[model samples]
Target: VLKDDLVYVADLFIGIQIINVSDPNNPTEFLRFGTTGANPRDLCIYESLLYYSTWYGGISVVNISNTLNPVEICHIWLSDRIEGLFVSYPYLYAANLEYSVSVFNITNPSSTYKMTEFHESVLVFDVFVVSNNIYLAGYAHGLSIMTLDKGGDLQEISQHFFPNHHHSLVIDEPYAYVGDKYSGLHVYNINCVANQRISVSLLKAGGFLALAIVLIKLSLKLLPKILEKLSPYKRGYGL
Candidate 1:
């Protein structure tokens, strides 16, 4: 029930519903449309359009310029079950349970065309776009970050795994909020390139510790004169 600007939500068992939330407490259910399937899992609203992915139905696009009378504009059939969807500029991306992520060109909303697909072993549960990058959450694969190539092709940038099953992810500013089934909610700081380095460091801390110990051993093997020169003070040991 987000009430800042507009309200967009998927009312499972009912349909994709949008409410006029200008009055917050007095939110009016303005649009209701039955989907081809039962559960409307997730949806996103952009400008005058609404994109939804259902548990059974592939994908649905609706025009909500007139809030009172929203119309179904297009529906794209998927090869497998879909759980989440996101729309950015002229593109739409869907997370499919068939262990893959699908991309579509939505320049012409009425006639969308498949752009590309990436296959994985784990189900893709949710996805979100930030700038030109796509962040995907997989049931077993954790997080996958991808970008669009100059030719509009999908390219994998990086992927990392957490301990629990990844369910959903939301990118806000320089942070990414991940919903892990067993871990509850996890917040990540995405402020700098150092963050990626920190993630890597955390992932291999055991090996790093071993390497530090080995380096200390190697340093101890140095000659007395070399050790003295490497020390902060020449023959003046700190108390």
Candidate 2:
């Protein structure tokens, strides 16, 4: 559920269903559409586009700009079972159970294609990414915090194991909420202190660079005065 009084539900074996939840009691079925494959694992919406991770069907993109009628826009086939999806602008990430994680370049919606696919040892149940940081809810691997390297490859930072089967995760600033089949909604305060190390180092490096520039400028300014003071030495003054 997002801002536009709309509800997008990934209807497992059926497909993607859109409902207008403005009225909580009597929600209206706005529209229902099927994907290329039978199972619609996850739904992610960005602006006017709706991204659907259809298991074995790759990813299906629909133009939901018109809420009343969502038209199929594009499809990218991966042949692997896509368990979850996360849309971060120019990129659409798909979490696969068997083939692992797949990344798609969706900078141009019309020409969306698979950018890269990599397999990690962990069981990928769901994936969420904000900026360079990625969060994955693993069935056996528990909760994994991964980061997207500059080369767009996922690198695991840390992982925590809960006493339940982890299903999905949602992040809210300083805290992260995990959905587990055994434990229900598990709330854990995200330890961002470790994540901030890189940022802190970058800030320190920036400050050093600024200080160097300032010192260089001061030296340049004082050089003229020093030369003026030593001018007599150079010209054999008082000789």
Candidate 3:
């Protein structure tokens, strides 16, 4: 839906049915690219390249530079089911149902190389990358944030736990909007990690403050008894 020059969209029913949608009201079928499997679920087009993730099959990279004769460049095998994908620069991040996210080096689109794997407790359904951080919709595990180095190694920055399953995530500037299956949509402010760290510090400070209050109360109650026993007449006070 991002491309305005997109002339056609393959229906993938009988084949890759092309519709000339130059005009929204009067769209025309131009061509078809036939294949032997189910249609693609989600796809992204970058320049002349088209990337798609399937249900039964893995990720498919196609050369759509020439839209008329689109050729299959490669099919990366991933046994773990995929739900969503986001490609940035030379890296591709896939949200897998196997409670993890798979990172691939797609610098050579014809041969996708598995770079690294990041695991979590809940099912990962969708993910998006902004700068070096990857935001994921972790079902049952809530929201997971990870930082990826230049080499594609993932370091789990932090995670926010929710009561329900999260299905989708969308980020706009400094905020992240997540869609939870049972709990509905949730919004998070991602301006900085300071907010997360602040919460942790507050909890620790609260515990320390409680301990101080308890010690002060105990001292207040015991001070009178100690003073009474410390009188010169009380022989036990000297010992």
Question: Model 3: residues >4 Å from true position, as ranges?
Answer: 7-20, 26-39, 194-239
lDDT sort, best first:
1, 2, 3
TM-score of each predicted structure versus truth: 0.75, 0.75, 0.71
Write one digit per residue (lDDT tens) for candidate 1, span 1-239: 23234566677678866678788679887767787666777776666777777765678888878766778889887657887677776888888988888898889888877789888768888887777878887776667778888887788777677654666665664655555554444455555422442132121113334434433443344335222221111000000
Q: By how many angstroms RMSD does model 1 differ from the true structure?
A: 17.6
Worst 10 residues of 3 by lDDT: 230-239
Q: Report the Cα lDDT for residue 31, model 2.
A: 81
Per-residue CA lDDT of candidate 2, range 97-206, in tens? 88377788898898898877767776677776755767777676666677778897767787666545556655554555455544344555665636532111111113
Q: Write the per-residue lDDT of candidate 3 for residues 21-122, one digit (tens) a residue.
A: 678788776667754346544455556676666656678887876777889988887666776677776788888888889888888888887889988888
lDDT for each candidate structure: 0.64, 0.63, 0.62
Count of backbone collisions within predicted model 1? 0
In model 1, the clashing pairs are none
Residue 203 in model 1: lDDT: 17
State each model's C-alpha RMSD to the native: 17.6, 21.9, 23.0
